[model samples]
Structure formats: structure tokens, C-alpha cells
Target: MSTFGTLFRVTTYGESHCKSVGCIVDGVPPGMELTEADIQPQMTRRRPGQSALSTPRDEKDLVQIQSGTEYGVTLGTPIGMLVRNEDQRPKDYSEMDIYPRPSHADWTYLQKYGVKARSGGGRSSARETIGRVAAGAIAEKYLRLSHNIEIVAFVSSVGPIHLFDPEATPSSDPAFQSLLSTITREKVDSFLPVRCPDTVASGKMADLIAEYRDKKDSIGGTVTCVIRNVPAGLGEPCFDKIEAKLAHAMLSIPATKGFEVGSGFKGTEIPGSKHNDMFVPHPTKPLSLATATNYSGGIQGGITNGENIYFKVAFKSPATISIAQQTASYTGEPGTLEAKGRHDPSVVPRAIPIVEAMAALVVMDMVLQQQSREATREMLGRAARLVPELSRQEEKAAVEGVEKVLEAVEKA
Candidate 1:
């Protein structure tokens, strides 16, 4: 289950306290220009020690491209990458041996595997997302170069403060639509620490995180991601819908509590007439259709509609706080557990790149599957055309069927 995607496969390895953490990415198109530098920016953005709002775990998260490329071009092979774990403190987690931290994976991991990492949460740690971010960077580069796709995610809410209230202002509101259409990473990062984009909201969110950090507590928040210029007809139907795949990928991240697409839960409050997205002629693309409204969130019937795909992911507060809590040990014994670790007071600020990365992986895998189907269909169409006798016979049958239908209607 560590491996993700059917066509564009990514398998990640290594735990939190392991020497290194990385991933092997398969199915990258050949001859594409790629390098470690292209993948490092997002990795650095996801790394810790960025600010006081995040964990002070000093990791450069410097990525090294180990294999599957030469001379800056991808070789259409599995790309191997690694980021060394330079700042691990095993002694900090000695107490984890006795008492499981509340709302953490320590006890469940032990129950599932009959063993757990002595130092940290192991695969359950947020450090596991490093591999995901690295693989996503590669996928994102391919998506950008091939399709001009742009993926941007920012902290939309921290605690009770939101960039805008979804209940009061639906996603169909002009202001929210404008933000989704025009918000860029540069504009998002310009408002640092919280990355909420709105000056007033980001300021308030930062102060709220500071309050939690001071109190030795933690808080949860939401990150909204927008993907643009996605080609239509990318997602699969039934079980593997794009939104379902997106939810799968997103919830796989370390603290994600919920996932919602388009207007999400708020749309439930509106009548169908208002929630519905009406089809209209595309503004720019001739002979194509676009939705007058976007309650569908750029997707209809489990397939993309060549519009912006936006969704929000909610992450729960980090469980490993410095505060003391009443909890139980591995045995049936009551105890007071005071967890120790350099954990983020709030994960939303640093979760921006992680959300964007997961989104890229989902879209990239779906695109590859779609391209393969298209290529196969094109080949079959060519074969069908080469058989002139079969083609003529089929055309005559179609004409006869239409004539019969017309005659039946006239008789009626």
C-alpha cells in the first residue's frame, strides 16, 4: 500500500528516525528536462524550522537525485531520491515506550505491526510526507511542462479564523472565485507564517498559533488547494473517480481529518436550482462548453470539465504537544503522559506544499492513465479506417437504421 498510482507509481520508504527518507517515482516521460534543483523548492517549503509557528526541528530537507536521470533529462525510468535525516533526537521520545501519546499513532502502530519505532512515530510521522513532496515535485514539473498546469495551496483557515466563511459566503461567491482563479504562491508566501493570503486573516491566524505555541498546546486548520488548466476527461468513473482518488491521496497525509471538493458541505444548504452548474458555450474555446456556475467544482460526472479544480483539506491539531495529559500505558495501567518533541504548534502553515504535492500526484497519475487510453483509441481508430469494406458496410447499416427510424416516425 506504500506504492501509489496505477501508471505513475511512487513507492516511498524510510521512517522518521531512519537515516534517510525518499521515494522512487516511475512513469516519467522520457527526454524531459529534470534535476534536483527543480524538486528542492517544494521540499524546502515543506521542511521544518521555517518559522516559530512550525516545529524547530532543523532539517534542510535537501534532496538528492540518486538515479533514473542523466544530463538533466529523465530517462523514462524509476527515479530514486533521498533526503538525509540530519536532526533526529531519539532521546526525546523515551517516554513513548511506556505511555502512548493521546490522539497519536504510537499505540495503533504497535497493535497493527506488533512493534513500533523506539524514537518517533516512524511511518506515522509527518516526516513520511517528505517522500510524497519529492515525488510530487517531479510529477508537478511534468504536468507544468506538458499541460501548463498550475497547482497552488495555502492556509485557508487556522482554528476558528477562516480566509472567508464558507457558510456565509459560498464558494460560488465572486470573491472566492477570484481568489481561486488568481491566487499565486508568491502572493501566498508574501503573507508568511500562516500563509492565509488575506492580510487581516493571516495576521490573526499567526497570533492564534503563537498563543497555542506559548501555551504548550496545538491547533488545527484547513488548507484549500486550487488546480488550474487541467484537461477535461481525466478522472475515471465508478470507484476511481478523480475526487475519490484525491480524497485517498489527501487523507493519506499525516493529520488530515476531512476532505471536501467544490462547494463541499456548504452547498447542501442551497436548493438544487442554485447548486446546479448550468452549461454554456465556452468563453474562449469554440464548440466547447463551460459551466456558468461552478458548484460542480470544475468536475461533473466524475470527470474534469477543463476548469479549475478546488478543494479543502482539514488537518487536526498535532497530538504531540508539550502539555501533560491523563492517558494509559501499553498495559492496563493509568498514568500521566507528558509528551516531548519539537512539534508544530499548528501544521497548516507548513502543510501548504504537502497538500499541493498530493494533488499533483493524483492529477499526474490520472493524466498518464488518460493518455494511455487515448493512444490506444487512436490506434484502434486508424485500424478501423484501414478496413474500407468494413467501414462502408457499417456506414450503410447506420444509414439504413436512421431511414427505418424516420419511416417508423412517419407511419406513426
Candidate 2:
């Protein structure tokens, strides 16, 4: 049930402070070039102890392929990977062995599953995001190559600390691919704690984190993501709508409490006429269509209309603050507990890659679905145009492909 997607499905596993946590990618296209190196950067971005703002849990987060790949190429099978839980301090959470952490999933998890892991947050921890970011790297590659699509996500806010202009934000302006090529270990280290591109905001955010750290408190913020160059007409209508799928993906991430596409909540303030995206035929190209406004967020009638797709997500403050809070134990016995051990005072920096990954995952599924449907439609149209001359095999292939596309969409 934790899995998402249709063509390139991914199911995340493991828990915080477990032996390991990872993901299984099902339905990825074969012969795509991939390796641990391809996934390492994203994993590193999500790893802990990278900066003064984050948890002090220093982890290499090294990814190891367990199946479905050979010699760095996908083998048309389920790709299984594991990132070992190194630098873990299980004993730090011993106080909660019988008494669950307040405001965490301890009671709910036990109530639903009858048992819970005592160490750290177990599966509820943000540590689980390692697999998602890794898998999303691959999904991003597929989407880029297949559709010339690119996804960009950045931390737009920290608590009430907002990055004024995105272009002014240092990390906000770089093409992630280009940045990847020039990224050095030294550069990576210097950017850690908070990955704000704007040095001024970064310093301010750093100071704020230090203040919060001293106070043993936490803060929340928002992340903005953009998917560019997506072709018009992806995503099915009704239940399998593209926006619905994206909403599902965003909600799946830990601590994500709010989601809004282009002009989302703001749209509520505008009239329907003002909110509607008016079609504007391109002046230079007759075949191309655009919209004067992107209020629809590059989607209309549950399909992509080929504009920049943008959205924002709000993450609640990390619940695992060091400050003491009052709550009951598993038996509803009230007591005071102060969270200890390594934990991110704020997750904005680490969450950037995770959001990008989820966006990539959704876009990849949409692209594949679009390709299948278009291929089938083209074949059918050709056969209908050349009736009685269509080959038997062509007819059968189109039928099969259409059926597969239908099945996938239905499942989504």
C-alpha cells in the first residue's frame, strides 16, 4: 500500500533505526543506464547530520542494489535496493521502549499493527525518505529522457523565514543536472545544514536554527516544486486524474500537511473567469497552444496542457523536538517526555530532494501512460484509415498495448 505509480511503481520499506531502509522499484524500463552513482547524490541530500540545523545522525546512506540490475543497467525486473543504517544510536530511544514518544505514531502504530519498534521513530521516521529519493532519481532520469521533462524543487520557506526571490536564492536557480556535474564534496559540505542558494537567507536561517536548537524547539515551512517541459495531454480523466495522483504523492511524504498547485488557495479568492486559463494559440506556430494564465497549473480537465507545472507543499515542524512535552504512554498513563538523540530541528533542507523525487515519480508515471495511449491511438487510427489492409499482427499488437495501457490507468 505504500507503493506509488503504475508503469514504474515503487514501494518503500524499512524504518528509522532498523537494520536498513530502502525501496523496491517495479516496472522500470529495461536497458536504461543506472548505478549507485546515479542515485547517490539524491540519497546524500536526504541523509542526516549534514548541517547544524539537521539531526546529528551522521550516515553515509550508501545505496546497494540487491536485485533487478546488472552491470549498471536495468534488467526489466523489480529493482531492489538497501541502504544500511549506519551511525545509529538505538539506545538513545530506550526510554520509549515501554512509553511511546508524545505526538508520534507510537500509539497509533501499535493500535493498528499491535506492535511498534522502540528505537527512534521506527518506520515513521523521515529516515525512510532515503529510498524514495534514490528511487526518484531513477524516475527523474526516465522522465527526462523520455519526455524532455525536468523537475526542480527548492526550500522556499523555513518557519516564517521565507526566501524572498527564488532567483536570488543560490540553490534555487541552478539546473539540478548542471549543478550535479560541477558538485564537489567540498561544495556539498559548504552548502549543508540549510541548502538555501541565497547566502544571506542561508545565514539568517542558520542563525534561526541555532536559536531553535538552543531553545530545544522546532519549526515548519513550505517547499515549492516545478515540473517543466511536460508535453500536453498526459494523465487520464476522472479517477486517475494527474492532479489527483500528484496530490496523493505529496501527501504520502512524512510531515506534509498541506498541498497547493498553481493558484491553489489563492484561486479561491478570484472569480471563475479570472481563475480560468484562457487558451492562446501560439503566434509563431499554428500547431502549438498555450495559455495566458497558468492558474490551472499546466493541467485542464485532468490532463496536462504543456506548461510549467508548479506546486507547493507545507511540512509541519518535526515532531521530535528535544524540548519536553506532556503526553500519555501506550496505556494512556500521562507523563512528561523530552525527545533525545539525533533529530532534525527543521527538515526543509533535507526535504528538498524528497519533494523533487515525488514530483519525478508522478511525472514518470504520467509520461508512460501518455506514451502508451498515444501509441495505441495512432495504431488504431492508421488501421481504420487503411481498413482491410491492416496486418493481423499489427492489429493484435495494438490491442495488447491498448489493453495494457487501460489496465495501468485503471490501477492508478
Candidate 3:
């Protein structure tokens, strides 16, 4: 399960206390400008100890690209990126080897593998996500430069503090609709600590995190990610639907407990007639289909409908808490044990980049798949010309289209 994606694949390796944690990204398009600079910012955003509300462990989390590049450009090979675990304190987790922290992966990993890491939960550690963030940075760069696709994610909720009213009117007000259609990553990151876009909500979320941290407890939260400018028909109709893949990518992250996309569960409350996205002509393209209402969240029938794709990821509170708890040990003996380790009070802020990264990966894979499917469809359509069309002009036009398709495939 470490490897993900059909076309553009990423396989992550290493663990929290390992010498390094990194990934090998395959299927990257060649000649993209890629350096440590492009991959570092997301790593920094996802790094621990960024603020008082996060873990106290101060890790630089610097990424080093080992291969798949030539002169700062991608070589169209498996790109290998590494970020050394520079701030691991394995001693703090020594007790976890026997006690098995409640709600953590300790006991599960041990039970599944018949052995576990002496310190953190090895592959289950959040630190492993560094590779995902790094690889997703590459996918994001490619998507942005190639397709003008923009992925933005922010802290949407912390415990009970939500950024928007779930039952409130959505995308109806012209001003509010415009704001959502044109939001940027900068605006999301503008409010720190909690990373919620609303300043008032941000302050409360930050306060909640700090309050929980002081009590040695943790809080859960949600992140909303928006992908804009993705062309229509980027997803498969059935098993590989865009929302399904996004859910798969997001839930793969540690502490993620749930997922929902556009309209989400709230849409269930509305009547089908009202919940449906009415069709409208594209603003500029007369023949193109666009939706008057985007309750579909930019996707329909498991495929992107050329609108903004928005989804929410729910992250459980960091499992490694400092609170003393009574839980059963491996030998089935009940005992009180206190867990020790630098952990986030809430996972939302750091999860922002993780969400964006996973989204980017999903889109990149889907885009490649769409391209492949298009190529095949074009060739098949070209073959269909063998059947009688009854018109010289139509046959001539089909011939020209087939030639053009062949030329493009050769170039690829």
C-alpha cells in the first residue's frame, strides 16, 4: 500500500527514527524545472514545531533530491527525494514498546507485523508523510505549469469551530461565489496557527489547540481543499472516479478518519431537484457545458465537470498524547501509562499541505490517465472511418483528424 497511483506512482519508504524518510516518484514528465527549492516550502509548512500550538520538536525537515533530475530539470525517470530525520528522540518512545499507546498504531502494527519499530510506529508515523509532501510538490508544479491547475487547502475546522455554517446558503450570493471561485493559497495561509481563512475562526481554533496542548490532550479538525482550473472529464466513470481517488489519497494519511466531497453530507438534506447542478453554457464557449449551481463541487458522475473540485478531510487528534491513560498491554494486563513524544495538539494546520499534496497527486494521475484514454479513443475513432460514412467531405475530415492524431502520438 506504500505505492499509490496508476499512471503517476509514488512509493514512500523509511520511518520516523530511520536515517532518512523519502519516496520514489515514477511517471513524471520530463524537463520540468525541479530543485530542492520547489520541494522545501511544503516540507517547511508540514514540519513540526512551526508554532506554539504544534509539537515542540524542532525539525528542519530539509529535502534532498537524489535522482531523476539533470541540471535542475526532471529527467522523466523515477525521482528520488530524501529528508533526513534530524530531530528524532527515540528515547521518548521507549515506553511505547511495551505499553502500546492507546489509539496509536503501536499495538496494531505489532499485531499485524509480528514485530514493530522500537520507537515510533515505523511506517505509520506522520513523519512518513514528508515523502508524500515532497512528491506531491513535483506533481503540483507540473499541474500548475502544464494545465494551470491550482490546488489550495486550509484548516476548515478545529473540533467544534467551523469556518462556514453547514446549513447556510452556499454559492448563491454573487460576491461569496466569486470569492470561492477565485480563492488562492496565499489567502488560506494568511491566517496562521490554525490556518483557517476566517480571522475570527482562526483565533478561536488556535486558542483551542493551545488549551488542549496544556492539558496533554489533543483535538481533531478538518481541512478543505479546492482544485481549480482542472479541465472537464479528468476522472474515470466507474472505480477510478476523481472523488474516490481523492478519498483514497487523503485517507491514506495518518490520523485521517473521514472524507467527503462537494455538497457532501449536507447535500443529503436538500431535495434532489434542488441539490442537482443545473446545466448552463460555458461563459465563453457556446457549445461547452457548465453548471449554474456547483453543488456538485465541480465533479459529476465521478468525473470532473470543468468546475472547481472541493473536498474535506477529517483528521483525528494526534494519537500520541502525553495524557496518562489506563489501557491493556501486549500481555493483556491493564495498567496506567503516560505517553511521551513531541506531537501536535491538532493535526489540521500541518495537514493543509498534506491535503494539497494528495490532491495534486490524484489530479496528476487522473490527467495522465485521461491523456492516455484520449489517445486511444482518437485512434479508435480513426479506425471507425473504415465503416461507410456516405459523404466524401466527412471521410476527408476524418482522415485529416486521424493524421493529426497520429502525428501527436508520434511526438509523445
Best by TM-score: 1
Q: Write the per-residue lDDT of candidate 1 for residues 1-412, one digit (tens) a residue.
A: 7898888999999898889999999988899999999999999889999998899999999999999999999999999999999999999999998998899998899999999999988999999999999999999999998999999999989999988874674577899999999999999999998899999999999999999999999999999999999999989999899999999999999999999999898888889988898889999999999988898888888899988999999999999998989988889699999888899999998999999999999999999999999999999999988899888889999999999999999999
- Deviation (Å) of 45 in candidate 3: 0.9
Name the 10 consecutive residues with the lowest summed lDDT in model 1. 164-173
Q: Give a tens-digit lDDT track for model 3, residues 16-63.
A: 898999999999999889999999999999999889988888889999
TM-score of each: 0.94, 0.86, 0.91
TM-score of 3: 0.91
Alpha-carbon local distance difference test for all models: 0.93, 0.80, 0.88
Model 3 RMSD in Å is 8.0
> Model 3 lDDT vs. the true structure?
0.88
Best-performing candidate as measured by lDDT: 1
* Residue 277 in model 2: lDDT: 74
All candidates: CA RMSD (Å): 7.4, 10.4, 8.0
Q: Mark the regions of model 3 whose C-alpha exceeds 4 Å error after superposition.
A: 169-176, 380-412
Which runs of model 1 end up more than 4 angstroms from their true locations?
A: 389-412
Ranking by TM-score: 1, 3, 2
